[model samples]
Target: MKNVEIYIKSTCSFCVKAKNLLKQNNIKFKEIFVENSTANLSKMIKRSKKTTVPQIFINKVHIGGYEDLIIFLKKNI
Candidate 1:
């Protein structure tokens, strides 16, 4: 089982696309919403070193953004 976590801004299209992909694959992920709060956004940036929505992690390992997630899924799934 993959312990997946994704940090997302509520209105980002990339975030929605990333989530759809995860759902399509039946990969249950914990979504950390950062759109409505600055603190959550900062935490995501600190954790992933990226100031972008859809920052993804699997098994506590940082996996970058939506495009990166596609690569990861292609190689691993």
Candidate 2:
């Protein structure tokens, strides 16, 4: 199993979808909510080099957002 980390916002539909996909695959993840804090948002930006909700990392590798995650799953699963 890989160590999965997801940066998400509470009300984002894509974030919900991403989490659901992971759940369906039985993949556990650490979720960092960046909806309210600038510090966390900045951290997510720095870590992912992206300004999007649902930035995902698996085993410290940046895997991008929901669409990218779906692509990764299709190729790797």
The whole-model lDDT of each prediction reads 0.92, 0.94
Q: Taking the tens digit of each residue's C-alpha lDDT, what string does model 1 give over 1-77?
A: 37999999888999999999999999999999998889988999899988988999999999999999999999998
Q: What lDDT tens digits, residue by residue, belong to model 2 across residues 1-77?
A: 49999999999999999999999999999999998989999999999999989999999999999999999998989
Q: Which stretches of candidate 2 lie over 4 Å from their true place?
A: none
Candidate RMSDs in Å, in order, are 1.0, 0.9
TM-score, every prediction: 0.93, 0.94
Best by TM-score: 2
Candidate 2 global TM-score? 0.94
> How many residue pairs clash (N, CA or C atoms closer than 3 angstroms) in each of the candidate models, in the order given?
0, 0
Error of 1 at 40 (Å): 1.4
Overall local distance difference test of candidate 2: 0.94
